[model samples]
Target: AQTVTQSQPEMSVQEAETVTLSCTYDTSESDYYLFWYKQPPSRQMILVIRQEAYKQQNATENRFSVNFQKAAKSFSLKISDSQLGDAAMYFCAYSKDSNYQLIWGAGTKLIIKP
Candidate 1:
């Protein structure tokens, strides 16, 4: 069984600063994918970053990057130049090769301080 764990329940960062959200997962499968999804007040799950288990390089998108430690089974999201729009509930998820069923974390609420 695979499980995602988010130790932080809530996090706050000043606008224009940076913040990192922690995530860890347990899985026996060798081939899988890790993802960080952000759900805003609108309740839409938006993909922040994705990391393939087979890839050694971390994944990044604009100001968002992931520190994917395959050996430690940890995938943390780092938001650079945080903005108010970045404030949301972040969820760490895992999916086996082509499996649509995502094992999700409890979620971390990110608050952007003005």
Candidate 2:
């Protein structure tokens, strides 16, 4: 069975600072895609970052970066110089090319403190 765990249910960081949201996943597939999505008040899931299991380089998008540890099955999201817009429900998910369904974690609510 595949699963993702986010130990922190909620996180708070001051504006313009950095915050890392921890996520650990369990999967048997050697090749898969790890994802981090943010759902704001609008409830739209925005892709923050994505990483391939086989790729050694971490994926980064603007202020968002991922610390992907394939051996440890850990894929954590890092937000640098966070802004108020960054506050949202952050979800960690993983999916294989063969499987269209995404296995998601209990989202962590990020609160940006001004």
Candidate 3:
């Protein structure tokens, strides 16, 4: 069985700073994909970033990036220049061999302090 664990239930960051959210997973499969999804007040799950287990380079999208440590099974999200709009519930998910069925984390609520 695969499971994603998010140790932090909630996090806060001041506007214009950076925040990193932690995630860890357990899986027997050697190949898999990791993702971070953001759900705002509207309840829409938005894909923040993704990382392939085989890729040595961490995935990045603009101010959003992931520190993917495959050996340690750690995938953390770093949000740069945090803004009010960045406040949301972030979930860490895992998919094996492109199954598309995601094993999800409990989710972390990010609050932006002005």
Number of the predicted model whose TM-score against the real structure is largest: 3
Question: For candidate 2, lDDT tens digit of each residue in 1-114?
Answer: 988999999999999999999999988889999999999988998888888888999999999999999899899999999999999999999898646699999999999999
Residues 1-114, candidate 1, lDDT per residue (tens digit)? 889999999999999999999999999888899999999999999988889999999999999999999889999999999999999999999998775699999999999999
Candidate that scores best on lDDT: 3
Query: Candidate 2, 99: how far from true, in Å?
Result: 4.1
Q: List the residue pairs that clash in candidate 1.
A: none
Residue 67 miss distance in model 1 (angstroms): 0.2
Who is ahead in TM-score, 1 or 3? 3
**What RMSD does each model have against the real structure?**
0.8, 1.0, 0.7
Candidate 3 stretches with Cα past 4 Å from truth are: none
Task: Assess the local accuracy of residue 4 in candidate 1 as a C-alpha lDDT between 0 and 100.
Answer: 95
Query: Which 10-residue span in candidate 2 carries the lowest summed lDDT?
Result: 94-103
Clashes of each: 0, 0, 0
lDDT of each: 0.95, 0.93, 0.96
Better of 1 and 2 by TM-score: 1
